[model samples]
Target: MTHVSTRPLEQSEFDIWQQAIARQFADAQVAAGLWTEEEALDRAVEANRTLLPDGLDTRHMILLRGVLADGTPIGRLWIGLTHPRGVAGCAYLYDIEVDPGFRGRGLGRALLAAAEATARDHGATHLELNVFGDNPTAIGLYSTAGFEVVTQQMRKRLS
Candidate 1:
């Protein structure tokens, strides 16, 4: 079995990751009908500012880098505590990504375990995250990792 571990994300890399996440999250919100493109972008910016008031120095968020046993960084996982992006109180997995080269090696699964452990450490009974419906791979992974759907929204475009 391959072993994995988590460490605090370094500021240099976190900056790049944060910007990308905010934009992507905004896009996802638009796709899900949670907000219009402009609204989603504005909300994403506001949310990031509120949660990371001090940028990488914010204490309310936990930004972690997943590494292999030899100390190679494979991915990053962002979890929000003070401001759960998914639900009011439950810790939210704002973003998690395994390097393209590191995918399919069970690293993603390891991160889920680490996230659950971290959530539990913070007294949360469950962790919530939002995955775009089009990403079947992620949906399957989360399902196998013991995550169940809380609710869903569907749309039928009438021609």
Candidate 2:
């Protein structure tokens, strides 16, 4: 069996993770129709800045690096404590990524499991996230991980 573990994001690696996070937010927002590609890029920068004013030290957010038993870094995961609208206590998966070189291995599944354990430790009873509608791969993964659609939005482009 392979062993996967997570560690708190080190100060030295925060810069790289921050850049990747910006990209993820922009891409996800564009996919979800919440913003155009350009607008997503602009707003991603602004939103991330606000959410992570102190970088990894930001309150209510947990950032971790995924590594193999031998200490080979393979991915990053971001989880946050959030209360969306009527929901009172929940953990939101802000981001999760497996390095390009490490893709297709089940690292993502491991990361999600880690997120749940960490969230529980923080007193979160529910978990939530927003994934781009078009990404069936991610949707399927989340579904198998026990996440179901609580709400859905649809849009039509008109000529």
* Global lDDT of each candidate: 0.83, 0.83
Q: Tell how far residue 54 is off in model 2, in angstroms.
A: 1.5
**Model 1 residue 16 lDDT?**
83
TM-score versus the correct structure, for each prediction: 0.84, 0.89
Q: What stretches of model 2 exceed 4 Å from their correct place? A: 31-33, 84-86
Clashes of 2: 0
What ranges in model 1 sit over 4 Å off? 30-43, 83-89
lDDT of 2 by residue, 1-159 (tens): 245789999998888777777887788777677788867777888888888888888888888998998999988888888754537788888888888998788888887788888888899999898887787878988999999899998889999
Q: State which candidate has the highest TM-score.
A: 2
* Candidate 2 global Cα RMSD: 1.9
